[model samples]
Target: MSNDDGSMKELVEFVAKALVDEVDRIEISEITGNQTNIIELKVAKEDIGKVIGRQGRTADAIRTILNCAAAKLNRRYILQIIDE
Candidate 1:
């Protein structure tokens, strides 16, 4: 989401593309609020596993990265992984 300086959608796209084999099918959306920025990630059905990883560790890692970056900018962000 837009965090005053710039949009965090780029980060979402990068993460989604990295996680999916079918990069062309990946989609990322941003939702921002006073509290936090939400990044929704959608990928090809077959590649969902790659994004989520075993026990959702990979997904958590993505969120962690988002949070870390946001913290550096003195902003807040969240990554919401979805399938569509």
Candidate 2:
């Protein structure tokens, strides 16, 4: 992965860790493709609600930020919040 790719991963990790109570339980995986990147975020089952927030607004906000950042890098980022 390129430095920009790693930075995007870290960006998701940092935000996810802050929202979930179990910071250590948060896991982020990145799948880089030619045109788009997928960021899979897993958090503790109990903390899933916290990360998602009501009406999914929180998640949407995170995606919005990610989209803006990815645009600057000329990439597309898809954030998938996985509960496990």
Say which candidate scores most in lDDT.
2
lDDT of 2: 0.92
The Cα local distance difference test for each model comes to 0.78, 0.92
lDDT of 2 by residue, 1-84 (tens): 779879999998989988888998988999888898999999999999998899999999999999999999999999999998
Tens-digit lDDT string for candidate 1 (38-62): 7788888899899999999998888
Clashes of each: 0, 0
lDDT, residue 26, candidate 2 = 89
Give candidate 1 regions above 4 Å deviation: 1-7
Task: Name the TM-score of candidate 1.
Answer: 0.85
Scored by Cα lDDT, where does model 1 land? 0.78
